[model samples]
Target: MMTQGTLVDATIIEAPSSTKNKEQQRDPEMHQTKKGNQWHFGMKAHIGVDAKSGLTHSLVTTAANEHDLNQLGNLLHGEEQFVSADAGYQGAPQREELAEVDVDWLIAERPAR
Candidate 1:
């Protein structure tokens, strides 16, 4: 019998939306594929990882070209109270988006220059 279990990687990543070309940047999928290479297709998968539980609260699979700040809103929309991510997720709009949802989002600041 073919075993088809609910393999929930939990952090697999967001799915894709369209084919990439020159004009388009981000897509519905989280990853993208490149051309010519053996393993092509480059994609970006937005993910929200819980620091303590390592649970994926939210995930968005957009094109690799998608901005972290742009996708930051998706993470904030999750039920998690606090979230952590790289500097790519830093910005004003993201903060406001989180605040709007009444979610206590805390993004660590980079050390002083």
Candidate 2:
């Protein structure tokens, strides 16, 4: 059966700091990303999975500083009935992209409280 929905998310994987190394240099591929008040330094793993079956369909890696929505299009196969993502993907550009592909956007909504 075709995929009914796609779930998209991103996680930060920490790496050793360059300053602590002998060369005092960091991995250029790794970068810093801030979520709320906290900061994380590493690489970002962007994953797309079949929501109903829980099978991974795609993955895209990038510097931690990259925005999740920037890689959203790459995660889709254009066969899902809808796409669900975190609130970070709730924006005009993202919505427009989903619209272009004729997929329903199911982005998480922020709580009122």
What's the TM-score of each model vs. the native? Answer: 0.50, 0.85
> In model 2, which regions exceed 4 Å deviation?
19-24, 92-99
- Any runs in candidate 1 off by more than 4 Å, and if so which? 1-41, 92-96, 110-113
Write model 2 residue lDDT over 10-93, tens digit each, in one string.
999888655344676677788888888988889999999999889999999999999988889989988998889988888824
- Best candidate (score: TM-score): 2
Tell me the deviation in Å of residue 62 in model 2.
0.4
- Residue 106 deviation, candidate 2, in Å? 0.6
Model 2: per-residue Cα lDDT at residue 76: 90
Query: How high is the CA lDDT of each candidate model?
Result: 0.48, 0.84
